[model samples]
Target: MVTTSIPTTTKSWTVLGTDGFDSLKFSKDTPLPAVSDYEVLVKFHAASLNYRDLIIPKGQYPFAQKPGIVPGSDGAGEVVAVGNKVTLFKPGAKVVTLFNQGHLGGSLNPQTSATGLGGVIDGTLRQYGTFNENGLVDMPASLNWQEASTLSCAALTAWNALYGLNKLQPGQTVLTQGTGGVSIFAAQFAIAAGATVISTTSSAEKGELLKKLGVDHVINYNETPDWGAKAKELTPKGEGVDHIVEVGGPTTMEQSLNAIKIDGTITIIGFLGGVQGEKQPGFLDALVRMCTVRGVLVGNRVQFEEMNRAIEANKIKPVVDPKVFSLEDAKSAYQYMWDRKHFGKLTIKIE
Candidate 1:
C-alpha cells in the first residue's frame, strides 16, 4: 500500500458568517494549500485593508460571500515553492497577490468578478497560500512588504481610476475627496503625472498633511460644505477640475458634478460617506455636462504591472498609517479602519 503525506497547516483569519466585524475569527489549524501545476505556494509577509474588506463580512458587498472564506484582498509575500509548470515565478521571488485572479487583461466580465479575492473565494489573510502564477505580480523593487501590500486594492483602484480608462494628462486638475488610502494614492499619482491636485479633508490637520504631500490646494470640507463649488473656483480660470476621484457616493456625487469641467471624468471608486441616504447623480447629470463617469475596480494584472513600473520610476511611496498590527490583532485593525481615523493604509503583519 502507498502512503501519501498530509499537507502542512497554518494559522489564518476568516469571516465565519454574515455578522460583520465580530465574524472575523482566527483558526490555528487551517490547512496550507498545495501548489498545482500552474500554482505557487507563498509565505505571506504582510497584508493591508480596503474599505471593501470591512463590509464584505457583513454581506454588504455587491458580490455574494462564500462561507468561512478568508477575509483579505491585499497582500505581499515570498514564494516558497512553485509547481513544475510555473515559470513566471520561482521559489524566493517577492510578489504581491492580484485582487482578481482571472482578470489578467482586457475588460471586466462575469469571470473577472468571480475572481475577486475575499469576495467569492479564499483570500490573502492566511499565513500560507497557493495561487496560480498568473494571479500574482512581482512586487515593486522599491517597496517593502507592507508597502507593496497596499497596492493590491486601494492603490490599484486609484491607479485604474486615473490611468485605466482615459489616461489622465499632465497640466490637468484632479480633485480627491478625503485622505483615505485611495484618495492619497490618487493625489500622488495625479501629481506624478504632472497634474494639479486639489484635496478635501474633514479636519485642519489632514488638510495640512495633504499640503505637505504637494497638493496644489486643500479644502476643509468640514469648514466648507460647498466644497465642490470651491474646488471649481480653485481651478485655472474657474474651468473646473479635469478629473474628480469620486470616493463618496450619493453624499458627494452632486458636488463632484459641480466641480468637474465639461467633458471631464469622474471615477467612482468608493462610498466612504455611506452607501444609502440622499439620491445620487443620475445619467442626466453626466449627460448634461458631457462627462464620463466610471466605476473603478482594482485594476488587472497588466495595469498592476504598469502601476508598479510607474511606482519604481517615480519613486512613489504609499502613505501608510503609523499604527501597525499583528495577525492576531486584525479585528482591532479593521475597527480602526472603520473609525476612519487613519489617514492612509492600515496594515497587518503575518508572523
Candidate 2:
C-alpha cells in the first residue's frame, strides 16, 4: 500500500580493481535492471564496512571476480521498486538484506544462489541495488539506516554462533577476542543473554569501555601473553569458559582452545590476526578432549530476522565507532579498518 515517487537513475561508487574504490561515479547511463518477479529494488541510504571488503583487492578470496564489482555487503535503505510478485516489501518501505543471498537457515542451496553482494555480485555501496524479497527484512522502527546496516553481517554472525550453534545459556561464560565488529557484537550478545563475557584487547582504554558494557572480565593481551589461562582462572568452575567467539584464526586458535571448558564450543569466524599463522601446541589433543570447533560463515535471511527480533526485544545497541565517512571517503574507511585502530563498527553514510 506504500507508494512513492520513482527516480530515473542513481549514482554509485564502483570498485574497479586493487586501485581502490572510486567515488560517486554517475550511473545515469546505466539503465536500471528490470525487477524479477520475486525481487525488489532498494535505494541505499547508508552502509557499513566489514573486513571482507578489505580482502577483495589482494585477491585473497577467489570468488571476487573481475573489476567494476561494487564492494560492500552490509547496508540499509528504502524500497524504491518492487516486482509484481514481491509481497514481503512494498515500494517506500525501509529494509535491509542479508549478507549471503542464497544460504538461508544454515542450509546451503543453489536455489537462492550463494552470490555475495560486493563480491560475486554488485553490492549496496551504490545508491540502487536489487535483491530477492526473501533476502530482505523490514528495518525496525527504532533503527536508522546506519544502525540497521550494522545488523546484516557482524551482529547476525555473532547471533548464530552464540545462540544458534552454541545455544549459550544465561549463566554460561563466553570468551571473545579484540574489539572488531564480530568480537564486540559477541560481547554484547553474550551480555544480553545473561551470560558472563570475558573479552581481550590490546588497548587498556578499549578494555575499559568493554567493562562498562557489562563485560565480566577484560584481559590486556599485551600485558598477559597467556591471556587464555587468565580466562580459565576467572570462570566460576576454575576450569575454562563455556564458549569462545573465535575471530583471530590460527594465531589465537590454540589459546582459544586452551581457554575453553573441556566440552566447550569455539566458533571460528575470521583470521583477523593472521590467515596462515601457526596454531598453538596441543590443539589436536584439545579437540580430542571433547571441545567443539565450528567455522562460521555470516548467516542467512532467517537468522537475520531472528537476530533483529532479539535486538528489538532486548533493546540491544551495536557499539559503533565514532568515525563517519561520506561515500567518497570509503577508501579511507578501508585503510582505517586495515590499520586495526577502530574500536567498533566503521560506517559510511550515504543519502
Candidate 3:
C-alpha cells in the first residue's frame, strides 16, 4: 500500500570512489528505487554517521565496498510504501535501518556478515530507500527521528557488549571509556540497568558532562595515564570493574587490562586508539588477567529490537552531538566526527 504520493526521484548522496569524505556526491535526481514484494520503501527523515561512513570511501573496511554506494548504516524514517508481501511493516510504520540486514538471530556467520549496509550494498544516505522488510526494526515510539537514527549501530553494539554475553546485573560495575556513541550508550544502558558506571574522558568539562549522565565516577585519562588502576580501585573494595567496554584497540588495551576484574569481561568494539604500535596488544594479556576478552560486531535484529524496547522503557535519550548537519553538508559532519569534537552521535537531517 502506498500511503503517500511517491516521487520519481529522491535526493541523495553517493560514494563515487574511495577518496574519503570528498567522494560523497550529492544527487538531486537520484532515481527512487521500486519497492519489491517483501520490501518496504522508507522515506528517511534523519540519518547518523558512523566511523565506516568515513572509512568506506578510503576502502579500509574489512567488508566489500560498492562503488557509488549510498554511505550510511543508521537511518530513521517512515514506511511511505510497502509491497504486498511486506508483512512486518505497513505503510506509515516508523522504522530504523538495521546494520546487518541478513543476520536476524543466532550466530552471525560469513553469509550474514556480507549484508552490512553502506559498504557491501547501497545504504540509507538517500531520502528514500527500498529495504527488505527484515532490514529494519520498529523505531522506539518515544524518540524523535534524529534520536532514533542513532540506534542501528552504536546503540546495538553497546547493548550487545553489556547484555549479550554475561548479562549485566543490577549491582555490577561497568567501566566505559570516552564519550563516543558506543561509550555513551554503554554508560546509559549500564546506569539504566542499575549498575555503577565509571567513564573516562580527555577534559574536566567532558568528565563533568559524563558525571551528569549518572556515571558514578569520571576519570580524566590525560591527567591519569594509570586510569585503568584508578578505575579498578573505584570498584567494590579496590577490585576491578565487572565489564569494560574497550573501544580503544592496541593503544588503550594496557589500561583496559589494568582495569578488568579477575574473571571479568572486556568487550573490544573498536580501534579508536589507533592499531599501530611498536608491539600490538594481544590476547595473552587478557589470558594473564584471567578475564574473558570478546569482540563485538554491531548486533542482530533481535538485539536491535531488544535494545529499542530497553531505550523506551528507560526513557533513554540518545546523546546526539549539539551541532546538527544538513544532508548537503554531510562531508563536514564526517570531518567533525573524525576531529572527535562531538560528544556523542553525529547526525544529519535528511528530509
Candidate 4:
C-alpha cells in the first residue's frame, strides 16, 4: 500500500517436490506475491538451518510433510515494504521471523503449531518474503543478521527449555548434552543467568571449546558412558543439576535422569541419539526423582520478544558456524548440517 519496493520477481530456493535433497531447486525469477492487508514484505539477509531442514527433506520429521515450499525457519532481515493495514513494522525496520507464525502468546496448540514457518507455510529461503505483521519481531540492535537469524528456532527453543516452566535462577547447575545450537545456547543462557554449566561432548577439541564458552566441566561421553553420574558428582554436594538440556532423547535420557536432582527439570529438545531400544521414560522415572520432563517446541512470540530483550541487554551472541554459504549453495549447506560436524547453526546468506 505505502510501497517502497513494489511487487516484482525475486530469487528463491524452493523444494520442487519430495525427492530428498535433490528436490531443492533455485530460480532467479520466482514471482513475488503481493502483500496482503496485514502483511509486510521482508528482504531476507540471512537464514540458519535446523535439524528439521535435514529430516524434513527425507520425510523423516514427525507431523511435518515433504517440502513443496520454501524451507527455512530462522532468518533475519529488513522490512522493505508494508501493506496499508500494517502498523507493527515500517520499511527499513530490522526484523526476525517468528518460527510459528500463528501462535503469538500463551500455550502452543495444534492449530498454532501447524503455522510453523518453512513447514506448514512457505519459509525464509528467498531473497524477499511477505509475512503477516504478527509473524516478525524487531531484531535486537546488538545482533547482526547472522546472529539474529539463529534465534527463530534454536535460540528460542533453548530459551523455552530454560525459562518456560520456571525462570532459570542464578547458582543453579545445568547439564547440556552437546555443542549444537540449542545446547550452546542453553549453556550461554545459563551462564548469563549466573548458573553453573556442565556439558557433554564426544570430541576433546569440542570440550576445550566448550570450556572457552565458560562451561564449568566437559565430559567426554564416548569415554564416560556414565557421564550423567559424573555430572552429578561435579555438582555442589553431588546433589545433581537443576536442569538438563535433554537433546539426546532416548539414549541419553537415562543419563539425564542420573544427572538430575530430586526435583530438577529435564527439557527434551532433540533426538540426535539413535533409539537403540533404550527404555522409553515412564511414570516410574518421574516417580523416582519427582522431576519434571518437558518437551519444548520453539516458543511463542512473547517469549521470543523476551529472549530478544535479554540477548540485547546481555550482548549474548549466537554461535554461528564459520563456514559460510550463499543462497545458491543452500542444498550443500543442508548436507553440511546432516553431517553434524559443525559446532553451531549453519547459515546461508541471501544475496
- lDDT, candidate 2, residue 119? 75
Can you tell me which runs of candidate 1 are displaced by over 4 Å?
A: 1-7
lDDT of 3 by residue, 226-260 (tens): 99999989999988999999998888888888999
Q: What is candidate 3's TM-score against the reference?
A: 0.97
How accurate locally is residue 129 in candidate 1, as Cα lDDT from 0 to 100?
81
lDDT (Cα, tens digit) per residue for candidate 2, span 158-275 = 9878976659999999999988888889888888889999999998889899999899899999999899889999999688899999998878887887788988898988888776
What lDDT score belongs to each candidate, Candidate 1 first?
Answer: 0.88, 0.80, 0.89, 0.90
**Candidate 4 C-alpha lDDT tens digits along 182-213:** 99999999999999999999999999999998
Pull out the clashing pairs in model 2: none
TM-score for each model? 0.97, 0.92, 0.97, 0.97
lDDT of 3: 0.89
* Off by more than 4 A, model 4: none
Shift in Å, residue 73, candidate 3? 0.4
Better of 2 and 3 by lDDT: 3
